[model samples]
Target: CGIFRLVVPCGAGKTISALRYALQTAERYEKRRIFYIAPYNSILEQNADEIARYIGDDSAVLRHHSNIVFKQDDGEKETKYKLLTENWLQSPVIATSAVQFLDTLFASKTSAVRRMQALGNAIIIVDEIQALPIKVLKLFNAAMNFLSSFCNTSILLCSATQPLLDELNDYRICPPRDIIQDVDRYNEAFRRVEIVDCIRGNGFSSDEAADFIFGLAQKVKSMLAIVNTKATARRIAERILKLSCGDSEYKVFHLSTNMCPAHRSTVIREMRRYLSDEKSSKKIICVSTTLIEAGVDLSFEHVVRSLTGLDSIVQSAGRCNRNRETICGTLSLIYINDEKIGKLDHIKEAQEITREILYHIHMNADRYPGGALSKAAMDEFYSKYYRSLKREMAFPLKDDPEHTIIDLLTNSPVGSERKQTAGGILLKQAFREAGEAFEVIDNTGKHSVIVEYNDDARKHIHILLSSHFIYEQKKQLRYLQQYTVQLPTYTIEKIGAGIVQENEIGVMILSNEFYDKVYGIDDELKI
Candidate 1:
């Protein structure tokens, strides 16, 4: 029935605090269900396990997500967990990925709809609210507004960099009262990194940048380099390996959506040991896409980020000086003159607005010695950003303002288009059309593919494809969670021969020949 926001910055204990609220709400409200939604599974896995332990009962906890379970069960009997996922019932505390939550909000299927009504009166916690894509902001806002107004849900928007959703004219709610009372003090308490502009010389290409990082690797214990694309990440990692003199003792890690969840998990576990060992002199360099910017939590002495949104810059900064173990970590914004990132309009636009903010701050650099990420600088940065992007906060489609998925889902009037009845009830909800228009991950369409990541995943895949025993198949699915990755839909069509194979279940499979041992899904996959 209300909205509350926790504007806690990253690495500032938001997860633990959110869990406390979930527990308190369950106890205070008497078995009211609690829905905790995060933007990525990397966070869900870590937080879900922690929450299950703190709550003192595994039976009460629910982890519902796309990776864990598929929508179609194919005549197999449902497990208790799968049944809960289907009905969204009887669990006091549930954690899910943002994709699952958003997709469910607009899904037309009977199973997906069954969960929506039960969400009324639950405590809905949306973490990393800023990460919501601009194209879908209007739809997301409408969904949030409906949940609070009609469903009577206490919606909590939690993020270190809260986007202030209700600020839009028609979004919803009175200015949400901050759940984290002292915003200024909270940010001050967790100040861990300093932003430094790495604009020097002729600007560095991915190759030159990797060489620069390779040199730094010889001196530093651990570092992270974040780039815009998977291709760029792979190029940098390749450059690093080639530039090595074959004499250095170090490890270069590559991470992206190309790697299955299980592969990424293995890399993270191995890297964590190296990062935590202070006595060990091994240097570690991780080349990754923006996936590492948000949830994966390993701190590094230095972080080099390809120019992107200021919000993403803040996230990248979070990965630095994360543990508060040092004086301050360094966050450098790298300008790759040779690389041109124009395909993604959203990211490119954000980068343009960020550059403008940087220009204004660069003019007064002497007054504010802390660079563009300082409190005052960040305020100005976001001001220009939100102002420039105010219209885009609402979703739009060409020649059809009345037909955007947002208008259809909410039954909102759209300028002489759809009419309502005297009862103020929509005659047609158009659930199927809404679902067709909604694409949480589709900047471009992607196809989910299973991979032979390891022996465990291979065994699970085989069992899942052939097994008739319902219990064993259900268990195999939980095991296969880490072995799935989504590839661009076009890529799957092009590489359809020896590499891509369709299983009996009708899902795509990328053979081992196509999966890279190092960078994952060979950089040459596009061809």
Candidate 2:
């Protein structure tokens, strides 16, 4: 009775609908709280704040994620307690990123399970479910089954382009019934955007993409170009600014993780202001990373998206004509073949398969069901993608007989008393092994720095170095959440003699010369 699916398209009011459903589900089913798990902290914070507004009680909502530390407040110690003790099992309505959600289920640490008791009989809504890494699909699926069947919790899988999870042989997840109502009718009713594939014969180099995007920028009142890498976004945005020389009518901006959350939020607000009123004359062109593709609700007249995955392309399309602001918005899908795309192996593989589907659709339009954004096309794309990466999906451990942690967890060798067998074999989830294996963001050697971008940031930094110790530092950490950036491990290593102060646990302070007001962390230094 707990496992359900929300199969709505992107930009179709999924968040608000989830909020309303959460309220009703809580009231009717006697569920104590609703837990929302988003793919990114930015998305989780954005939605949690919005839901707080709708519920008319900000304090009722508690945010839990890796990026957040407790701020000044004695009454709201539950959140702080979780922070201090690492037990995150309370709150009436909890908002967390997928990383935190998985840690609760898979991590072997004592702190990870302290809150597991609270998960029973709760309402769990997972947004962007399709974004789950292919390698951990089997593990995540099994965890969901445990939560729903054994824990007495209700689960809802939500996404615009929901994957065919039930179709996967290794990890089959079948919902009781899809909440999509009418799949075809719902899809037909919300057709506010058309996807156009312009990947071309050899894909675009950075120069070619920037030139093409600049040309596209001139025609629309508001446009968004989403790239895969921050380096590409910076390079392309800088090139556009250079080419603009004297064009003052158009407002151009660059957005990525390089910018703090607050800075990105400010940029989003400005973009929405320009898009809301047609009478405004100036155009807005934003060059951004894939961060804007999820939960962010601003729309544009056109979206220029670089191909990565079918799920990503759909999310990008959601940002254009999101509320039916226009008759129809256009999605210009292009493929880049250069180093500009970064070294994400999964994305590169998905890129190839997406192109194969698009090429086939281009060759024969009649046979394909719903054009590029149709169900038939996405189904074929993911099916091939999963098949291509089947071996990786099991998440095999190299030294541990190439068997997945999921295999070990389900088939345990350790008996009831937490003791090993006579043959000296130890196997049971390999909690430590699984924890070490998880790399959602892979910030291994990266260091987190509090960027002094404004007065608010500076005030926090002062408290950070003060005698208040970890408590004061943690309070500042909360304040600096939106004003934080992760520099590469190598960049921190090259802080040089007396250049800057650093720590072994991934904390570094930026000197005046290394920080920039515009780009947050200075990208001028070559890593």
Candidate 3:
């Protein structure tokens, strides 16, 4: 009837359990529809597949995300799919990214607002709820309040380490009911991996870290290292490959946003094959960015995670010993001294705070009886993290330092009562300004570049270039999303027109020379 939260450990099957609850509630209350939202495209893809299998009808679930592209079909099928995607109402169950869901609730664009009515009398399930950006705390809480209070919608938020949303001073949501009576019991029961802190005075250099990770992989036979940035990930992966030059049995893989969706999926599939096959003799080592930290289904014998937020560490640890098959799996947290995080203010701040928390945990272990991954530790982490980010939680506008997105959407100084004339209220709420200012991800200077990674990608690009009609090319562009990567415009420019250039249809396409078969876009390609 209102907003309810479910707190469960990573491996407790929260996905299917949440689905069961949503279905039951929908059937009982005769809800209009059910929407399952996640924070990233990776999580959306996994959940969409699982929900399709559970419902026993793939067509009943509508996937709405950046990577989703419906195949070319007959006119009837195309029209039906297009209509469902446009308004997001006809589908019985919709699996979409949080970007889409949040925009539908907050964005002022007609295309986005058109779907807002569909959310009424619906049950919304949000997975990995803590992945929300700190800047949108107040706005997100306000949106949830509107949907639950006035729209007759039920919202279920599921997270391993939930944030304290109620602690916000303004636009707070109703106090949510906890579905799980004792979350600490489940946390203890699902405890599979232990955290090994490897952070020292100035941390280890990339070469030293790579050497240590390589040695550990040789012993463990399977390991995953998640770094903070793409440059660090590629550097560590290349160094590991150089160290294991003559080792024929070892397979090294790299994953980051620089790789297209299809390429990343292919790498993940191969990693899973080697990890799951008991008879296979291949020793697998994967170096990836934080993209693989949440809602990814890969399990490793050992994991190395770059020091960041405690919540992120918990999510990374979920990838190790996930099935509880290993007797003792370890997730070593290390700090790369040479890694440059100057532009990554959030991660840097979180790292400093996490270091402090780890120091306290080591010095006073008795206070945190449930260890680092316990509820007690998570509570302290969020409390400190939120306090540090209190100023940004209001989503202050950069260009207009005097007001915030909340103020623009609700009350603006321009639309005061004194300005009204003849009993007519002036349009004071700045919808266009707010919409232009809001960004789920900072896309200020980013541009999407379609890469010719495989035969399918090339086929799409060829069609996109050769198509005579603009409508056909639009469809081809959608199909190419599975093979596209977003890079900073400055980086693209520095890479030079020799490697990246616009096609006949004005789409940015990266040549094959700069992309690697295993490591994705070459970090050294930039001039």
Provide the lDDT at 14 for model 2: 87
TM-score of each predicted structure versus truth? 0.87, 0.89, 0.95
Q: Where is model 2 more than 4 Å wrong at Cα?
A: 66-90, 277-279, 396-403, 410-429, 435-439, 494-499, 502-506, 522-527
Kindly report which residue stretches of model 3 are placed more than 4 angstroms away from their true locations once superposed. 73-75, 414-424, 499-504
RMSD of 1: 4.0
TM-score of 1: 0.87
Clashing pairs in 1: 1-152, 8-160, 9-160, 262-482
Residue 183 local lDDT, model 2: 63
Estimate, for each residue in 1-527, the C-alpha lDDT of model 1 and write its tens digit: 57788777679888778878766865776636899898888888778887888878977778887556433464353456667787777778889888888777875667667788768888888888877777677677777777877877778888877775665656644457677776656676777888888767667978888987777666667789999988888889888877764445777889988888878888989899888887877678899889989866789988999888888998899899788657887888877776657567767777778787788777877654455555455566556666676656555543465456666556644422433443545445555666666667664476667788778667767777778766666566666767877777667766777454535445566787778867778545742
Off by more than 4 A, model 1: 29-31, 69-78, 365-371, 374-383, 386-403, 409-432, 443-445, 464-481, 493-496, 500-505
State the lDDT of candidate 3 residue by residue for 12-49, as single tens digits: 79999999999999999999899999998888998899
lDDT of 1 at 174: 48
Better of 1 and 2 by TM-score: 2
Instruction: Please rank every candidate by TM-score, starting with the best.
Output: 3, 2, 1
How high is the lDDT of residue 171 in model 3?
71
The lDDT of each candidate is 0.74, 0.75, 0.85
Among these predicted structures, which one has the highest lDDT?
3
Task: Tell me model 1's lDDT, rounded to 2 decimals.
Answer: 0.74
